[model samples]
Target chain A: NGTLVVAEHTNEKLVPITLNTITAASKLGEVTCLVAGSQCAKVAEEISKVQGVKKILLADNEVYKGFLPESLTPLLVAAQNQFKFTHILAGATAMGKSLIPRVAAKLDVSPVSDIIGINDTDTFVRTIYAGNAIQTVKSKDSVKLITVRGTAFEAAQVEGGSGATEQAPTVDVKNELSEFVSQELTKSDRPELTSARTVVSGGRGMKNGDNFKLLYDLADKMNAAVGASRAAVDAGFVPNDMQVGQTGKIVAPDLYIAVGISGAIQHLAGMKDSKVIVAINKDPEAPIFQVADYGLVADLFKAVPEMTDAMNK
Target chain B: MNPFDEIAVEEAVRMKEKKLATEIVAISCGPQQCQETLRTALAMGVDRAIHVLVDPKDYEGLQPIHVSKIIANAAKEEKADIVLLGKQAIDDDCNQTGQMTAALLDWPQATFASKVEKTNGDLQVIREIDGGLETIKVKVPAVLTADLRLNEPRYATLPNIMKAKKKPLASKKPSDYGVDMTPRQEIVSVEDPPVRQAGQKVENVDDLVGKLKDAGLV
Candidate 1:
């Protein structure tokens, strides 16, 4: 009755989200982390040290280099047949979002997605309507497939475990359907938005992309990630990847500083779980102030630079 | 009827207008009210519509797997070279139909497409990945899901609406496609999220910084 956690990683290193997924998987039962990628032995080795994981299943092959769902789904189905595991879980990252549903469909089971809490082995809680409503779903299927929201769970410690590592039988499932082409990512030295301890986000009130420089300076001072609301992204003040909201990334950083954000409900859905929230907006009636731990009503142009100077001092 | 679907339909029509496609068929699975949604697509320049009729109540809990099975069957029946859909429906927010449909049909898929272009018969799809954009090229007879930035859907004019009334609309049942509508998951309960507590106001940046420092957050 152990759970299989689908590990997320770049070829070089395991992603922090996988640690969170492992933490969620531990709540179900004994945890077995599955590291599927081309030359992922290092990743499997790293996962074996995670506190809650009991075993590591390594599937190394060239077919898995890109993490395409078409190729990965068959591997999962094959893994399930061999292990006969009761639960399969992954973090609700981009790769998980693309992979889990297809696997669930192929297995002829319903997939509970973006779950925030686990009531039992079969019952889970997730939000809907952009966090306005929370729904608790119970899976009647014999095998439960789930994608846990990373922000909702604490990450498992990466040390003090000696889980056994074993090689999974290779399954050849060729998908001529799609091929991996190319990727253009925004390489940044700052922490990822969802995993950052401190985050500084801008909204449409930033006025222009250039104005984000203020946020970047403040973020550098705090060693924080920079994020934006949908308004800022739509207004072309920032890239879509920087957007943090219902339709973007969900983050629960320890400290979240909202600069010039009016705080639409969609935006709040992504960051409401932060440990401490600070809202800075010109409008005193903004919805963001409702959830902020400390609200400052002032023009952001004046306030942001002053805060940055204070932090610098 | 979903805004994302509307964007998909709009993109298909634009492709047809650009001579990249000769015909655009709009298909939906839901209650009769879905016909109105299809009509809007027809008015926007779809060649016809196929309605897979089901009771609205019965469709309430149908999961993405069932919907993808039905849509894949329809695509096979029509011999579709390309299937387009919204990334995710606002109601369920599953974001799985397109990928599942592609898997069911055993075709290529590109999801969360913000920009799509037809180049030398292959489709160049610029997708919105986790933190940036990735452009992939998939052969024809593929599935592409529209994202928010795809395009602003155009309104159907009154004259186009009148003409749409005359366009062909075929109705069928889920049984026709041999898809079972049974849901595999059950909803135990739905409730509002806990309300956040009210917060205190700070007078200036100095006060705000002090509060953050007091909380040991700065």
Candidate 2:
């Protein structure tokens, strides 16, 4: 049996989550990753080194750039048809969330999303109600389509594999549906929020956009990514991309430090899966304290600077 | 109503007010209780509502594929020019229905749309993606999933809620749309997620740093 993982990648490098998906895919069967992008040979070469991968199916085409779901959906269906893959998987990031559902629809199969645990070839575990409940589901679809939550799975090694690379069969990737206009990606020196080891987040208590510098200073000291709560984003203290909540990015970093943030249930859903949660809020009764592994009740304006200095020292 | 879906309904109302849309139709696939959500949509100024009624027992079995099919059929029946929906359902968080529906209808889709504007019958949609934002252009007969930043939904006024009672609300079964609601996956069990117990409360930054070192986190 073979499982096909639709690799997530930039033109030059493989997204790290794809490696995590490979780890999840390896649990199923012989892992083959489909790398579809423009000038993506580097990405294919990178996946070839991933430990669990047995083969890399490279599809280099201009249409694959931006990883548009409309174009990629047809390629995935065609690949599944030609290969007869029993399972198709991708990391449950924004790209995967947008593409897999359409592929599942075209294939006339159900798509299971953001699965955390694989019970067997057919059964999987996933969280629902914004992490309030965990459900184990067994798939009956002939071709199982799934999106793996990157945080839930350990990443496969990006080195020490000898997978062969093959040219994927061509498919009609042209679509009259949507055209890409432009993208405004945040160019940050720190790690990505979803993949970071440490994340220091600010909330409404930060008061204004300038006050976010305190959290940023602390984040830089800890080598952590800077994030914000929905309250902070809604209050115009930061952009929506920094938001961590049920509707925003879900993160499960090793250390998630909440500064000046009250943990709303939605906010808790995003970061509660973190390994060690630390809350630095003035209010002791804030919901954030209930989940924190190390809660320090103090003024973040004063405490964050102190913590940054202490960590640096 | 799902919070994102509420934003969808609000966007539809705004589009109608801008004369960009002639009508706004809202659809919900769930148990009978879903009608309450539909009423809310109507109260938010949708022209009408369609409730694809499934029993609670069967509702658990109805996945996004079935919902997409039901929605696709309704879109065809209504001769709709545009389909607006939430990026993900708050209950299941499937985040699939919009894309799947677009595929089934062979229409373009803009999922996780933070901003949508109509220009010469085409929509310029700004989407929320992993790293940041992406803007795209798609013609009508499209599916758009509302993101949180799309708009802050307005509370329905008392008169609007009263008027919503007279709005057209229709109920149909999955079979009516030729959809087989047989579940693809069996739910084995649903349990509470592992609770994280609260740990030591540090008094100061030095204690916090010490705790971090002890945990080998830094």
Query: Any runs in candidate 2 off by more than 4 Å, and if so which?
Result: none
True contacts kept of each: 0.74, 0.88
lDDT of 2 by residue, B94-152 (tens): 89999999999999999999999987778999999888899998978899999988999
Write down the RMSD of all candidates, one decimal each.
1.6, 1.2
Residue pairs whose backbone atoms clash in candidate 1: none
Q: Candidate 1 residues A44-160, lDDT tens each?
A: 889888899999988888888678888888889888999988899999877888888788878877788899999999999999888889998888899998998998888999999
Supply candidate 1's per-residue lDDT for A227: 99
Interface RMSD for all numbered candidates: 1.2, 0.9
Q: Mind giving the per-residue lDDT tens digits that candidate 2 earns over A113-221? A: 9999999999999989988999999999998999999988999997899899999989977867788889999898988898999999999999999999988888888
Interface RMSD of 1: 1.2
TM-scores for chain B, listed for all candidates? 0.95, 0.96
